[model samples]
Target: MSGEKLSLKDLARKRDLLAPGHRLCAGCGAAIVARLVMKATRGPTIVACATGCLEVATTIFPYTAWRVPWIHSAFENVASTASGIEAGLKALKRAGKLKYDHVDVIAFGGDGATYDIGFQAISGAFERGHDILYVLYDNEAYMNTGIQRSGGTPKYASTTTSPAGKVIPGKLELKKPISHIMVAHRIPYVATASPAYPLDLMRKVRRGLEVEGPAFIHILAPCPRGWRFDPRYTIEMARLAVQTCVFPLWEAENGKYKLTGVSRSIARNPKMKKPVEEYLKRQGRFRHLFTPENRHLVDEIQKIVDEEWNWLLKMCQLS
Candidate 1:
């Protein structure tokens, strides 16, 4: 697809909607995801941002990073706030007072907000069929609050709340299947994406926005500080996540599953294996995963991921 129109590089060139001079960390995958999301949005888009790294980083004092119309709402209310915005826009359109022909509303929140505190509001928006896109940049914990464990934290991952102990290893429960829950809601569109694959992410973002009802794009953002990995390895870690089947790239439109991108070579070929250790060893969160008892936990994780991949691929085929 290199020389063809709408190539990956061409889509990647869609840039600078969120300008330079923003205060995100050097390897903040959330920043990359937000940039691509903004690029793919059609019509006049307004954003409702929740309290998190992105909000504090961008809207520091008089300095604002977003070029689009954006509002800062309470962390748990971003989805509700975006719904309000959509309603206002619809009211204006009906009254012939709206300046734009089509107005798109988006809500930005972290995993803490989406998977924990804000889940009910998000579900309400989905159930009510709001015309908006809610993007959850899943760094997998409450990074803004001292790396505390949130509902999205993976099984056996360490966090401030669920720290490694002689008795307790770390977060013990499996990461909540946020996307699958949304899919159960039967929203018109739902997707899992990553900043490492910008083209794929952008394509999914565009598709989500075009859907008539509520849509969601859950992005797996790797946090250098939270994960205890070198900032430079952010993109590499994200790519490995997909290659190892730890995070799959796929979408659902009108309840039809579609696996948009897959590292099939990694799945089919033996040489492509990168030990789950490689992905985990870099992260302090999984420090306990190296323990003898927890060593098998890593294998279990791999097994779960592989099984999910197989099931999802079959679902895609059936779709």
Candidate 2:
């Protein structure tokens, strides 16, 4: 995929490893992410998906959209399960009992499973240096379970667990810095991707998979029902996320960091970056922030975004 230009016609002609007919939402960014991710596999790939929208929808009853070997893992143990698979495959290959020469192992989990419930397991796998790539399709909440606020949820974004009202704002906490945490591990690769840029996302996936050691990609996926946006606006929302610096597109390879895609331009010229409100205004979850009384909350959130972006730029410059 190095020089291959990704277009609708070209992608349609390629064999999608995730296949079509999955029951994911019409504009679910996770589905698009999963499809593009699988297209970057270098060899026979095995996927271990945590119990979430991707696992539940893609594997209903006996029917499955996965055209490759797949495992349905419990929500909090996807990393552990993927680590076991990788270990088993290596053991078999060492004993000369396995037919396949190589198999790329990947673990899939939502934000709830990744940033919260499965955090410890993922940390263990990364520390152990397992040969696996963990793809986190973060829609910023536990959307599969009634849209409850997870650690990945942004501040003031209303969810079932954190409803905004005259009495209280939505979630009070900022999003967990999962990417930075993973980068601190000094892994082979750690990237933040968005479905808005398919080529960038696919290239990162390929890089993550091709790397020798543990790798992780945190993908910003948009959910139509959870975010209260039109189905057609999923890609638009993703693109705005980068342009607004609400979710920057970048990667850290072996403790070295660099901004990728449009984020690089935003770093050089701050004027090119759009206001964070441009991203927040698109989703109904952040609608209350537009109110006269709640307007200050938007400013507060913007301050955090600005600071985070500045910190990220400084971090990249250090390398």
* Top lDDT prediction, candidate number: 2
**How does candidate 1 fare on TM-score?**
0.93
lDDT per residue (tens digit) for residues 151-249 in model 1: 999888888898988888888888898998999999999999978888788778887778888999999999998887888989988988876768888
Residue pairs clashing in model 2 are: none
Model 1, residue 237: distance off in Å is 0.8
Say what the RMSD of model 2 is: 1.6
TM-score of each: 0.93, 0.97
Off by over 4 Å in 1: 1-15, 263-275
* Per-residue lDDT of candidate 2, residues 1-319 (tens digit): 4423445566557699998999999999999999989977767899999989999999998799999999986999999999999999999999999899888999999999999999999999999999999999999999998899999999999999999977888999989999999999889899999999988898888889888889999999999999999999999999999999999999998989899989999998889999989999999999999999999999999999999999999999998
